[model samples]
Target: DAGITQSPRHKVTETGTPVTLRCHQTENHRYMYWYRQDPGHGLRLIHYSYGVKDTDKGEVSDGYSVSRSKTEDFLLTLESATSSQTSVYFCAISRDEAYEQYFGPGTRLTVT
Candidate 1:
């Protein structure tokens, strides 16, 4: 299994501000993903990266951006934070052709 961790763990910010969350992995996986968990929406994908500098939008990609400069790091950034974006964010990693994903601890973000 891959070891994954998210930074800050918790955050509180006002609307219109910029927020960036980080996800780090011990094992280098070919695929990395960012998802947000909400009360009713469940887990919705924000973005995913297959390789360094290669990324694509997911189900709920609006207001979010991602960058993968290195294999061990995947970043999720809110271009301009909004209250609607407040949710528990999770990072997941998987090997090539493997659908099983190992998720990070999760980051709780609150937008005021």
Candidate 2:
């Protein structure tokens, strides 16, 4: 739980469009992450933020970007969405790097 929330629980857009997803938390944890789940890929990290204004790219960050301006919010944006980028995006929060993470309900995005 950790009071995590993701906006736009479901979205559908055409290819080449821009999409932005918002993740919010009331836990005030120091670490927040974004991940995408697909049929074959399972769950893959897209990006993460360690602290306010401190973020890093993850394993599958090619088409995605993330930003954290405050401790409780993390934003993920797809500069140019594609059909291949369609997936269920999850937001996670953790108190520390090695601790367990609590995930949000997830946002399903589709690109046609």
Per-model RMSD to reference: 1.0, 0.7
* Candidate 2 pairs with clashing backbones: none
lDDT of 1 by residue, 34-57 (tens): 999999888999999999999999
Pairs clashing in candidate 1? Answer: none
Error of 2 at 17 (Å): 1.0
For TM-score, the strongest prediction is 2
List TM-score per model, in order: 0.96, 0.97
Model 1 whole-model lDDT (C-alpha atoms): 0.94
- Against the hidden true structure, what lDDT does model 2 obtain? 0.95
Alpha-carbon error at 72 in model 1, in Å? 0.4
Write the residue-wise lDDT of candidate 2 on 44-72 in tens digits. 99999999999999999998988898999
What is the lDDT of every predicted structure here? 0.94, 0.95
Error of 1 at 96 (Å): 1.9
Best by lDDT: 2
